[model samples]
Target: MTVPIEDVRAAAELVALGLRTGARPTDANPYGRLLERYRSQTLFRDTVDTVASGLGLVVLGAPARTGLVLSTQPGSVFAVRMGDLRSTGMSADEKLIAGLVVLGVAAYAFPQEADLDSSEVKTVEVAALDKFVRDSIERVLAVPGDPESVDGQARTAAELYRRTAAFRPKDRQPGPAKGCTQFAVAEVLGWLVERGAARQMPQLGASTFQLTDRFRLLVADVAGGEALEAMKAVRAGQH
Candidate 1:
């Protein structure tokens, strides 16, 4: 039997609320009053999942990794891979390289890849990866492309580098980065937090974030097989 349109609208609202607020629908609280009325957790979850999938995302726990998807759009906060990072003057080549640099750092530092959830990652390892990522980004940006503009390429890389600082936790109060070569890896880590994939831990002169269970579950499907290899190749470009 077909479901009523009202039910669909309510479900959509619930999905938005749950993702934005990170509240699971439950029978007791008003959080999921509709789901409670229906008396079905599976129904509510599946409905939310369906909505997320339609938007090229997958809702994990409420408010966590709220809308994690690899795709980028016109103005997605997820990454710079989407439309022009700025209004204009940025070349397609710059966009592609900058995106790859960000993507590489994210993939390598992924809890699934680095397994930060189960083990403590050495600070040296984190620093090394950051170096590799910055070098890779600069290399790609520096490489001459069709109708290349050296000054434009350098400027793009510099902008990306500056934006990298945008990721440092406001609380940590990190000082200014020396230059575009800096990782500002914190940005990727912040992205992880936004996606509910990881949570920040106490720092001892170094940064670390604990991976969440949902991260493991989601990556198992999206970060394995061919997708994993492709991600690896993207990261390898930095090497």
Candidate 2:
């Protein structure tokens, strides 16, 4: 099977484009076209896969597929790519929401004693997340605080979090254009959308998102083990 130099270059560029942007190109894009060709051509698949592996990436879309999921390199080593984080402009509260979103999705994606081959990802409503954060804040606020303060100094991160737990999620952070909880949820989902890891249901607007297979595959292990187990326990009322 003869291979053209142009095809090789095109395929490499397709991969490079995905890594740089953290998103896949549309099917009609030239990079996407060449990517499909390289994947389908038996002779070229190995070549492309080899290049992908060398670059600490994995080609996750099928040869016949239109959408590609150029995922990060597997394993904990690539668990949280610094480059991906830098691209996201998430504040502290939003970061917490992002972590919760993963746990929320993982609860359904990796069920216990299920026979399904692929993970069954669950959609999370923004309100549900907001309520969750709000509930936590409430619980923390209810707890009696230690009167001792270090030289009557400023509150630490944990202290601030505890204090804010009593406030409404929207009231927690003020001065932002959007309510803190709402903005955080939107930004977190937006980050996932940019990574091709999740997509918002147009009808659901900012309310809900369907976690993509890319998310199940990439985020599973990172969100797996005790974290997922805890979520499952909570769902079953065992926690």
Candidate 3:
């Protein structure tokens, strides 16, 4: 069967739009049209999926409103590693804390299963998120358990986080700090904004952010993990 070149071009264009950081379907002209085709035309949808797969990308979702959401495979050139989330000269503990910060943000933004399924946009404040993560870690650490098991590892991480300060002095530099959870959370949130997972809402506050559909898709994909489960449980207990 001869495939139409126009369909291929359209599929490629849609994939390119998906790859652009922070690009939503409603953001511009071609995105809305391409995404509409993806939803209405079977051939075009398959072609778009094929194009994404050929490039080692996963088409996570293409909801009518959110458009095409893509994630890179483990070894794909577009894959983002934990190292990519770190700044220059970060220690191992700080890196681990950064990873936990991400999980905290996800859990805090979507505390319930229904929240993840809903179309309602959720917002988070950096300072509040930092406090929540630290409190959750402390709660987990307080539980009596073996010191040589998975919970023990979690406790160790909690201890490390507990040692970190909630915030630094006002005169400190404007970046992540090894001893400040607030700065670390801010840095991680900034990275998420750049990756299209979240967007800053300055009107709400200087450090407030609203989660994006792209982030929802990503978190829903990994929502079953143990860490997220624990965090969700902690978040649930809070309110």
Candidate 4:
């Protein structure tokens, strides 16, 4: 089963915000290290393409050809590419939902790459995707038990980190903004750092970060190195 896209988005924002300004896991507790891993010490070498593939979805860098693939399980959405092979028994609505989620995520991951923004995603206009993800998990668990379903949520969460976990020193620096994008990226990277999936690169400068061996290992463990290579290949493929 597929997870709700909103949950994925919220998780990204939560991780991002936590990294940028620090996290308070509980209301009573002032500060929680839930995202301490994302600080300068850790990194997430995995790219959005890697994450998409990890979820058993076909990934393409082209937005015009990508779409979301929804599942009955919570956090089961996939970002499929246009020309990729289709999964068996995938419904039309499921494909539509998945397309929306993938597109939405891509808009955020590749801000400059896409013409869309966070506001353009249309999966959960009436209801927030985060609430849907949580609620869907609750419902699924009540009906029939599936551990993979639950882990799918975690995978989705991990994908959140994967999407925005790039080591863009140019983009990581503090820039003038009302909402704070650079800070958010820093915060997310901080979480990856804590998770042993990322590391800071002093050579890049005070504001930059790069991936470590541990980060590469984590991506391979979860999604395989094909996706990782795809993302890195992006740089080499560049003119």
- Model 2 CA lDDT for position 184: 50
TM accuracy, model 3: 0.86
Once fitted onto the true fold, the runs of candidate 3 whose alpha carbons sit more than 4 angstroms away are: 86-89, 139-156, 172-178
Better of 2 and 4 by TM-score: 2
Worst 10 residues of 2 by lDDT: 150-159
Task: Give the range of the ten consecutive residues with the poorest summed lDDT in model 4.
Answer: 61-70
Winner by TM-score = 3
Query: Where in model 2 is the C-alpha error above 4 Å?
Result: 1-4, 20-28, 63-66, 74-97, 108-122, 130-183, 220-223, 236-239
Kindly report which residue stretches of model 4 are placed more than 4 angstroms away from their true locations once superposed.
1-180, 224-233
Ranking by TM-score: 3, 2, 1, 4
Top of the candidates by lDDT: 3
Cα lDDT tens digits for candidate 4, 25-138: 443332222222212122221232234445543321111111111111224443223223233443433333342232222222222322222223211111122222222323
Model 1, 103-168: lDDT tens digits are 444455452455534434322233554555554444444444342353344435544653554323
**Candidate 2 lDDT, 21-56, residue by residue in tens:** 354545777656766766577767766776677777
Kindly list the per-residue Cα lDDT of model 3 for residues 70-185, writing each as its tens digit: 98877898888667875575777776777778888888888788887888988999889988898788666665557655455556667878887787755565644547888888
Judge candidate 3 at residue 228 and give its lDDT: 62
Stretches of candidate 1 off by over 4 Å are: 4-10, 21-46, 53-98, 109-128, 132-178, 203-206, 213-239
Task: Quote model 4's TM-score.
Answer: 0.26
lDDT, candidate 2, equals 0.52
**lDDT of candidates 1 onward, in order:** 0.46, 0.52, 0.81, 0.31
